[model samples]
Target: MTPIFRRLLLVVFACGLPLMAVRAADPAPPPPAFQEGKEYGKLTTPMPPMVAGKPEVIEFFSYNCPHCHDLEPTAQEWLKRKPNDVQFIRVPVSFNPSWEVTSRAYYVAESLGVLEKMHRPLFEAIHRDKRSLASEDEVAALFVENGVDEAAFRKAYKSFQTETQMRRANQLVQRYGVRGVPMLVVNGQYDVRSPRMFEVVDFLLAR
Candidate 1:
């Protein structure tokens, strides 16, 4: 080849070396840490999230369940760092009459706009303090102690709206196939069962 032609060839090869190095340096993405039918199970039919345009993370728990109580701290820690795009919800499961009472209490607090204030106390009452909140009188007393008016607490405790929410909670428990407490469902698609559940949740959210 002529000197000009050889110079042109050298220029093209020099330009191509950096491009080839970049291609070789690019790393492949790591495989997913969790797996289907192992750490988590996908719903046969995925349900749409209650809140539109945002991912939902639901915790199906019961005040009467010791395991649920044990998970409270970890759940709260995860909530503190949960994605801003996530809409978290807690559904109190009622598998028996006693559980139904606490479920009603949860909805009552929700209706009165005191759920955040009462959630931890209720859990502590049942699990830590060994207090029994199995009756309306007992639960109402606790509400009163928390600065809620006795009359208003009683009214909301037995209100139709609270009952409706309790029913909805039950429906969600059934729909999600939640057979146990301290269960986490991601965007109504996967039911997480691993100990590293929040990790699985982060994985699903990234997906």
Candidate 2:
């Protein structure tokens, strides 16, 4: 074969082979199961926690919300395996005046250093046991039963710090534009709302 002719034939064969391979190749894999703005959303104004250098995972919840109660177990389990760099914060939202009492109760427990002991039990008391813990007195009684001093519980429930935290939580809800309970905010930027909430958070963290 002439040199020029052989060169042109080889080039044509190489180009044709690629086209054939392309035709035989499998289809592209389906898109990811999670879709931005559908399963989750970006916060226009991210309310990242003041904790420096750590990615924040905030759970916007309300004690009165049954969905939050349902999510408590799943959240606790996810915490066991969460990345070390991520700091999880649970913000009790006050949707209205009626919810303010429960919001206060959460911070109160936190202030008295009883949150670790009282968190899940409070959920069980209200949800599983069908107890009406909607008022300050009712909530305080539950705390007292949990071994916290009744007076200390009452003082903390109405303390300046607890009130401030409640106000800040409400402001954050408005800032994050969180419309519902049991919503997970990853690094204060991404709003995740799915049963696979922690999965989405882990994906964001990895990214």
Tens digits of per-residue lDDT, candidate 2, 3-112, equal 99888778878777642345557889998767787777787876656597788888889878899988787888989998787788888888887578878888988898
Count of clashing residue pairs in every prediction? 0, 0
RMSD of each: 3.6, 3.0
- How much lDDT does each candidate structure score? 0.88, 0.83
* Candidate achieving the largest lDDT: 1
Tens-place lDDT per residue, model 1, 97-158, is: 98898999999888889989989889999988999999999889889889988898889988
Query: Where is model 2 poorest over a 10-residue stretch in terms of lDDT?
Result: 16-25
Q: What TM-score does each of the candidates earn?
A: 0.85, 0.85
User: 144 in model 1: Cα distance from truth in Å?
Assistant: 1.5
After the best TM-score superposition of candidate 2, give how far the Cα of residue 110 lies from its true spot, in angstroms: 0.9
Q: Candidate 2, residue 59: CA error in Å?
A: 0.3
